[model samples]
Target: MKQNPTPAPIKINGSNIDLGEALPRKIQDELAHVAETYFGHLNHATVGFTRDGNWYCCTINVQVSNLKVIIAESSATDCHKAFDQSLAKVGRQLLRRKQRVADSRRVQMSAAALA
Candidate 1:
């Protein structure tokens, strides 16, 4: 059976609103819960929040076990929207990473089987 490792503490950087001011108990709890859901799937990650003009920007840099490094950035009028977009981007990255690993293993196995 595979055991999922505990998720590390989340660090947030925000513009306009201070970290405490921007996230209330409910919001902070929700963020932590969602982050933990991904747990061992992501080795390490950094999330940052900023704003420009009328847009809120969120950027996440993550390293998955099989994928060296992946970056996802999105802009929205709200922080939650930005997070949603960024998560979507990361999901795509995960799929690509998994596919690449599968392909590589297939090639290696084929070579070994032939030998």
Candidate 2:
């Protein structure tokens, strides 16, 4: 039987900045979608925002499994924009990581078998 895939949990933290009430929910939804698309299921994700002068720096950390963790970061004038940029980076990283993991687990045919 096939089982339904659940989105990974996400935690958001902002340092010296107000994330607004709805932005957090929106961010969570978007992050969950991205995580689900690439990893099927992940342990969890953490997003941190910090204001550096005029730019907002956003950092995203995704725990793909017990041993693998992916991190991405971006800086922009707006926190949302920074997050969007970082999320894009995360998606790319996740795809590459998935490919590597899949390749590593694939069984290779012995030379004798091909002969």
Candidate 3:
């Protein structure tokens, strides 16, 4: 008898490549946890945190099973707020995209029936 293969665990990779003080280690761990818990069975994740003077920016690229998701950078004078807002933006985009894919499928099926 052949054994079934289990799905691979998601991969999360983050770096404070430019601004260490702007993003604390605790926040980095939290970001990884949130992504694993909520991001549509993500296959891979890449995150970068940076700062411009007092402003902090967080950027994340999340890959799901079937889509490539790019989130715009989110910035604020407060580091925690900037990080939270960036993740929230990604969540909102996922919701909107889910609706769009469903709508497109409906249209395609309707057009096919008319043929």
What is each predicted model's overall lDDT from 0 to 1? 0.67, 0.85, 0.62
- Candidate 2: how large is its RMSD? 2.7
Residues 4-77, model 1: lDDT tens digits:
66654455667674545544343345444444444345455667889898888988776655557778899998
Model 2 lDDT per residue over 1-115, tens place:
4435665678899998999988798888888778778766668889999999999999999886554788999999999899999999999988898887777666343444666
Q: TM-score per candidate, in order? A: 0.75, 0.83, 0.62
Better of 1 and 2 by lDDT: 2
RMSD after Cα superposition, model 3: 5.5
- Name the regions of candidate 3 deviating beyond 4 angstroms: 1-39, 111-115
TM-score of 3: 0.62
- The parts of candidate 1 lying over 4 Å away from their true place are 1-4, 18-40
CA lDDT, candidate 1, residue 42: 48
User: What lDDT is obtained when candidate 1 is compared to the true structure?
Assistant: 0.67
Number of the top-ranking candidate, with lDDT as the measure = 2
Best by TM-score: 2
Candidate 1, pairs of clashing residues: none
